[model samples]
Target: MSGEPEPGLVPEHQRPRHDECESVLLTVDGEQFRVCAQAGRPGAYDFDWLSGPHEYGFGLTNSGGLALSRDELVQAIREFLAEIDPATGYLAE
Candidate 1:
């Protein structure tokens, strides 16, 4: 795959975390975080792993969450990343 990154997906490190596929992979601490777009009904899409890693595994606990709008993507990512506690699987206040 090409190393070029996508617009919405952000890359961590120099690696091509973001690919042509509208998805992003980030590594925080020793944890690997990934989010991808899932197709919904016609003319609709939702992001998987919106809540980020909650159980300290590869994927986040919140897989099939509400579909976020374009404007909300960045804020949602920030909120989820800030709230998730990898070890405890609990969101910080």
Candidate 2:
């Protein structure tokens, strides 16, 4: 094979930059969230609540790693949503 990744494989150097990464907007139970690939870390993702008062709510107290599969990410979002306080749109202390 040539100096290239196999046809079905993605090479690390060819990964998209942070700004170029595609973000997904999800509305779960009327709460909006944005999920996108984390910068400098391939296959890793970062997420934030678009309708929450806290900008760093997801990161502030979350101990989960950024690297997660699509399904895992969705599960994490659900878990995060469960922790939110409907009255304030912030995680429960």
Candidate 1 C-alpha lDDT tens digits along 1-93:
111112232234322223533565544444444545433322222233434433221222223354444444544444455655657555544
TM-score of each: 0.32, 0.56
lDDT of 2 by residue, 11-76 (tens): 445434547766777776677767766555555545656786655324211234335555665666
**Which numbered prediction scores highest in lDDT against the true structure?**
2
Candidate 1, poorest ten consecutive residues by summed lDDT: 1-10
Q: What is the C-alpha lDDT of each candidate?
A: 0.38, 0.54
Give the worst 10-residue stretch by lDDT in candidate 2: 1-10
Alpha-carbon error at 55 in model 1, in Å? 3.6
Off by over 4 Å in 2: 1-18, 54-56, 59-67
**How many steric clashes between backbone atoms does each model show?**
0, 0
TM-score of candidate 2 relative to the true fold: 0.56
lDDT computed for candidate 2 = 0.54
